[model samples]
Target: MADFGEILESIGDFGLFQKLLLFALCFPNLILPFQLSSLVFNHADTNHHCNADWILQVGPNLTKEEQLNLTLPRLPDGSFDPCKMYVPMDWDLSAIREYGLNETTTCTDGWVHNDTIYDATIVTDFDLVCENTNIFRAAQTIFFAGVLVGAVLFGPFSESFGRKRATQIPMVLMLIFTVVTGLSPNFYVYLASQFIVGVALGGFRINSIILATEWIGVAQRSYAACLSQVLAALGQVMFLAVVYFVRDWRIDQFIMAGPLGFIVVYIWFIPESARWLLYRGKTTDAKELIQKAAAINKRTVPDSLLDKALEEKPVEKGGIKMLFASRVLRKYFLTITFAWCAVNLAYYSLSLNVGKFGLNIFLNQLIFGLSEIPVHFFCMWSLEAAGRKLSLMGALIVGGVLCLLTLAVPQSNYVAIATLATCGRFLMNGAGSICYVYFQELFPTAIRQTATGLGSTASRAASMLSPVVNMLEIYHFTIPTVVIGSLALASGIMAFLLPETRRTELPDSTEEAEGKRGPKLSNPATRDCEDIQATKL
Candidate 1:
């Protein structure tokens, strides 16, 4: 029987229709960075100090600057400390300058904040500064915790309910919650919204990638995986530009939500995955989508293609049980789970920590997004050349080493640290992109989304821990680097333990998946050659 790949070949795999699908799917990918790191700009730090300075007693009329100068200790950066103030006592206005008021204490009065750059952020609005900072960081932790739950939910949802519901529900909810987050009047409301948005985005993020991927043939899988991320990078660039114009976090949220929310309208156009439909015993629905694919791509559907796809009866229902059923699969499952966790931990840690390198945050974010573009492009090509295992392993090891090298660079040199950090980002981006394609390849069609969702859960767990790792800088600066670097190094070594999947067909059954050794020759699918050649035009 000709499997789905041959059937896809008969119906013009990756032709005009697929390109159109890619453009439509790119919306979620584009808006992802806005939700993912909206706080980076939305909670931007502002200059602040204790209110009712001791100098106010010196004279009824003193400039805000003079009050701050006389009352606050200077930070290492030449800025006045926001958390501490001089003791208020009787003093002569004329002799105040001569008085040695070296005594100081933590701010007893409310703070006076200065916002020269950002008009408002959660930090300014709610005063998420000083001791309240951890609660603010907890917003992200709460968000990732929501994502962790989402990853567990979406994969199984997509498998049981079909991809369209799994995807579109999250798409709409993510948009709604993002706007609500902006409008939230207090920290708790804002954190609740952040958590829901994270939940919605987690489902949309993993399931959408799998939905489109399952439709394409083996030959296009490598580039298809990164295409999703390239669209995300494009969104991040646009997000940086948007932040420059919209300084208020609340207004920024509305801007990101309004236009991209239109994606919800396009949901009607998104076809159900025919493969997933067939796996769930909906052969009639599968054939209908197949026919639509043929008409849109301007090709004839092979007769009885759905019948061929159904020849190897799939397990009636797909779930996490399949992931642990076989020793080989269980090992692959554990190894890739760790790899995904390490990749996300390293990626989020560096991204959130970019402000510490003393570069402009917007510029650093723009450059970081730009720097990782080449890695995706490289993955687009290298997935075929280096193959999945070598490429994934190389990215983890090299990215890990580059990050560790940061410890050797002097703190005074922001440029060197930023450069090495960007390079590490590049490698991790490669690993992450490769793993998206590679993990899906490791499973059969019936259980693929389930396994992917489970993997997403583990990665979210890592992301939840990442902020705490980033926070370790206060205790010891090197601790974060050591933790992230060691995970990456260990994950890279684990990559060697998995079988290589180069030009191999997506497994049709769990038994078939377990039967094969990992490495396969990097050969073009000759079955797909004529169709792919036609696609070149």
Candidate 2:
């Protein structure tokens, strides 16, 4: 009888079957983070009780004399009339009093007294404003920033430690911080917890993606990665139901954080990446993991295959410096970095702002999340059949153009503009999903994780600016939309300059990558001349 390792080696050496299995294993990890985005968006609302009656009643009820008193605070020139302070409809005095609204002073004082409770409730209602939006955006930025750090460090760490141990560390952290986030008593504590969670979340994201890719064959890598995100989108929808039922942000946080506890159980079910094991010179462990994988797949492996796979081990341990060693590698880095930045800017800006559009915030988010299913399939089909560059360019151009057209739709045409904006969102979401998979394929195994992390960091840098851009856009929608559109268009054009990777085997080295298309790879350079030229145009 063949041992488990021998069976796994016969499964076509990490092809479609392994990719599919990895997709299944990695699905939950992907969804958990994306769904958390919605949780943050939901909680970011500051104006949840805006329609609460007591809040409205706190304003001056304007008896003839009181109305005159209200007018007294105005400028003598009548330019700043205090009487113009209008109460919005739907504010409930009863709800305010029940929640401890002080009726003696205007409702404002009382509202501020119970601000935390009210804020928490309103966050559920999805009325987040500037401060809240900033907090939410900041949390996401820090999270991605953590991802950047993790991606860079994880490659080396995973190389030294076993891949299984490296992957589990983040999962453990995610569980711990997630629980801490729920128990946070104050905003500062909550923010800190989120930042910590970001670190864990970041690690989990990179490890899961890289591990899944490594275990699969090149032919199936793109589909596997894309499928992971697709399941993540499904998780987004599932979380909608979770948020709807849970209602409280803290409770929702706990719900999201809790699932990670079970992931540890995967230790028994999931095997370490054979590639990482091989690279680390642990032929015995690598062979063991491969055998286990074959057993899971119900296949038999031959002993001869395992003997043949035990190849050369390096004399010197390779570090991240290896990523920077060639001109072509540098080019790949720059292209992916800029591309990720543009994709993230457009992708996140739209996701963060979706609540502002005139639709039921929860329902709209659910719809938006669900839209990714079909859109992802479209992306997969287009990417496989059409060139990656062409598909990406088309999506970017369409999304950018649609965003620009949103400016033409009058504010009075809120419904029409919102519909158009959603279309733009759909395009960007699909494009972004494709870009993640595409970027992975563009780089070789040596620097794949490093390249991804750098690209992700660029994207995070862009994301850090998104809140500022969003705030600016609030003053005038047209200006920000135009800026986003311009960036998207530029990204599409930049993509045109990069080489296509479809049907080509992944480049073994930076020098090989450059030599395949345009340039000769020399010593590792910090920046690629070609990428600089593309950006300059």
Q: Enumerate clash totals for all models, in the order shown.
A: 0, 22
Q: What is candidate 1's lDDT per residue for 304-419, written digit by digit as tens?
A: 76568656453534356767877888898889889999999999999888778778888789889888777788888899888899998999999999999999999889989999
Model 2 stretches astray by more than 4 angstroms:
1-9, 13-20, 38-41, 46-144, 152-155, 295-305, 313-320, 515-537
The TM-score between candidate 1 and the true structure equals 0.91
Q: Evaluate model 2: give its TM-score.
A: 0.77
lDDT of 2 by residue, 1-537 (tens): 122222333655464457555755666644465435643454454422112232325554535444333322234784423222223334443443354322222123112112332225423333234234355556556555665566556655655665566677877777787788778766667667666666666566666766776666544556655676677778877777776676576677778765677775563456677766665567888777777666656666666767766665442323346666666566666765676677667766777777777776776778777877787778778877886778888988888899888888777776877777778878887777667777666765556656666666567667656656776765776666877888888887777776776655444445445645432222225237766778999
Q: Rate the local accuracy (lDDT) of all candidates.
A: 0.81, 0.62
Q: For this target, which candidate reaches the highest lDDT against the unseen true structure?
A: 1
Off by over 4 Å in 1: 53-58, 73-79, 86-105, 310-318, 517-537
